[model samples]
Target chain A: MLIKRPDDIKPSDITDEKIYHQRRAFLQAGSRAALAVAAGAVVPGLMFPGEAAAQVAALQFKKNARFSTDEEINSLKDITRYNNFYEFGTDKKDPAKYAHTLKTDPWNVRVEGEVEKPADYQLEDLIRESQLEERIYRMRCVEAWSMVIPWVGIPLSALIKRFKPTSKARYVEFTTLYDPAQMPGQKRGVLNWPYVEGLRMDEAMHPLTLLAVGLYGKVLPNQNGAPMRLVVPWKYGFKNIKSIVKIRFTETMPNTTWNLSGPQEYGFYANVNPEVDHPRWSQSRERRIGEFFKRKTKMFNGYEEQVASLYSGMDLRHSY
Target chain B: MMMYRMKPALIKPLVFIACLFPLVFGIWAGFTDQLGANPIEEITHRTGDWALRLLLITLAVTPLRRMLGWGWLLRVRRMLGLFAFFYACLHLLTYFVLDQFFDWDEILKDIIKRPYITIGFSAFVLLVPLAVTSTNAMMRRLGKRWGQLHQLVYVVAVFGILHYLWLVKADYLLPLIHAAILLALLLVRAWYQRQALSTRRTAPQTS
Candidate 1:
């Protein structure tokens, strides 16, 4: 009963067989319960090395055109962690642990704030309208850890284009689902609830920026942003808000949690640039998760060519 | 045990051998690579664990004798204290050798700069005089000074706990438990000593 053959199953399909087998093996060994429990207990870490690439393929992103490439999708899924970012009664692992309590089936997205076509879109309606594309990108966490993931979702620009941003809109702000009764983390002041993240106009329109729905070639894990989330590579991990329910086009800079915590420490642009180091440690060096001792991190996490141009003349130290 | 024998020589060997057990087990574990992946972490943890255990054992001797009617336990206190110093030395060695690769510049910088390492190193430095004066000959030569020197173990114990507490990420339950046990043992010794002094003062004349 746990295993169901997909209606669209075909041998020619490039869905990661390794991931399917890995999940099956994990289930067959009766490790699903333990893995699920442990996943909620530990700080969600980097994916197990080469498995990131395989896991990204399984997200079924290619069928969805919103994703730019499998590599982009791979980077998003591989970075993993469906954590909703409220480090309260639940820790980093709490989302996967407590998120099962959430009801994502009847989800909806409210498109407002300087949009020509302001509307409340049901989750099912959006899925039907937009084609999913898997994009793989390097995801860098603020805590000096990093992961590559393949995420299946439509580009935010593509979705936003449908709504048509007004000429006055120069920035995009996203809000996470906020209900104290539903999201237990909101009951306490773990972080200023209704977490907000923003992007500049150019960054928002970038082809790589995604509003993700699923990862690992499957429906988004509850611990991960189940209904919908943002994937903004080159930015610090927190910039990619998860379980988004609202999007607002704004003219001013938004107040983000980390930015509010220490404005000097976290700037408006939390891009993943090795040249910009946190005061505590150098960002130039990073330890690859599974490799532990072998692999060393590279500049812009090996995507320098794609994103470095965005910060052409600015001083990294000031922005860092 | 020491009471029935009425000989200092008898308990010394047993205590010495018991003190050596942690070293032997730790060495075997390290050599066989039983320390697990990140052998460095395992070695550091194991040595630090043994050091704390021995410190607790050393502190336990007096209270254990008073509460359990096993006065002989006090005879092994010096040996256990010395063994704690031994393990603390090994713990530092593992960090310096495998971890820092004896990079003097980095090692010196860590000792001077890192608060956790400083506490750990200071505790080790305080332990040196106690270990050096642990022998019966040194005890006889120093006499009153020996007792004063050995009391440094108390400072070492506090520093050891702080070293562990500062290094932990969160959920300091284990270090807190160790601190509680040390507190309980220290309180027991103080209470028992007060009772002994009072009893001696209140006793009737032999005449």
Candidate 2:
């Protein structure tokens, strides 16, 4: 977040504040090392070669009971290995195998459009002040499979509030990193390059919305969209765009990648509704990752109690 | 060339074991934990793939025999065709028992409402009669009509390709390759038919 007007800062105004100061020694060490980060001249990895870059800042996070579900999480191996990151490849296992090519340590998220404090944030600087929350939620894929994942991140609303979106910010658009060299799938025309996703202003600020930086209490593996990825639990998995590079706030609804690829099949609001079947198959039932028998899929992936109000009068069938 | 010279005693057993390889590999994969996270999906996909592949292989027999004069290819055609049906049955059983867990309502809904499943299941149904009438007695009883009845293999193969093409979300490469092979086989048959017609016209009339 851009702190252009430092004078107006209040403790309450500290949007998406999470204290990642888990290990005091790490923070004390981090503060000393932050001089290199703050200097912005050198790559941290070059300065300290061959260390576990992902472990550089193991977030000290606690589970947020208010938003977390008690559902059993999928095995970490399954969660990490079986991903739908089309950037790496179209196959379910492709991301886990090919995503290592992505250079994530020196990442930057360029915030743009309709925000008072639009600025590019280094992956570390963006979440350094934020305390992490582990929220377990069910992720339903449009392909009729689902996984329960425990994601660790700050509430996206807190992050949005920090950005201080203007009234014109009716919708928030996200774009995935576009370099074909790192993301080999971009070389093929499987999807329009640089995957895009969007959420309404209200949905962006919804407490359930999380910008996930880690998975299963570890720094997110590159396959699972390392550094940062959006986690809107109530929607289909694709709506949670990975490896986001830009956030554009728009008055009009943004065009999402899947929707653009097949408008009749995918929609702007990809809420998980069993009533509306996918063009290819039935949406009513889903095969859980390891389960033998299929389970009846719930509306909004069983998160309707919290989020149904967001689309109360609107016909989900039409919007879907 | 040596394969054609071999007796049915030697060749049929080899063909039978070769046909059983996919199922054996799947069962082995299941026990060894190589079936990945979703074994059910893996099983369903493998059976379906082999079923389609065997159907194409079965379709190729007549063309290869006619073009290259490998008359012995016809000896194994029935076994190849039966193997296609075997795998198709397994593919349908995988969907009916494993994927849907024998929920008749859901299975019926899929067959009637879902286009991909409808095509795939319909293709399986078309193969049942072909499999049942493979006996020498039934072939002799039907006589000339038997060849006409067996021609439904072409229709079933086409539907099988369509079923595969419709089921995928994107990345239609595999399905399209199957479709291209089917198209080429059809073209070859049509060309052979035209050549036979022209030769018949040029010859003296039997009347």
User: Pick by TM-score: which candidate is best?
Assistant: 2
What are the Cα lDDT values of the candidates? 0.66, 0.82
lDDT of 1 by residue, A1-320 (tens): 11112222232332433322222112222333334334432211111112222122222225432223343232332244333356323344456456655556567789888889889987656653125556666676665555567666776666766777777777788888888776777777646777788887667766567787766555566556766788887687789888788888877777876677568667778887676666433465443333233234456556567567666797867865
TM-score of the first chain in candidate 2 relative to the native first chain:
0.85
Q: Which residue window of length 10 is worst by lDDT in model 2 chain A? A: A42-51
Q: What value does the interface RMSD of model 2 take?
A: 1.1
> Going through the candidates in order, what is chain B's TM-score?
0.86, 0.95
Top lDDT hit:
2
lDDT tens string, model 1, B28-111? 987885544345556778889999889988988877887888767777777788788888888989878865567687678668
* Cα error, candidate 1, residue A56 (Å): 15
Off by over 4 Å in 1: A1-59, A63-94, A117-119, A127-130, A180-190, B1-207
lDDT of 2: 0.82
**For residues A42-153, what per-residue lDDT tens digits would candidate 2 score against the true structure?**
3232223222454353444666655666777789888987888988887888987888788886788999999999999886666742466677889999989999998888
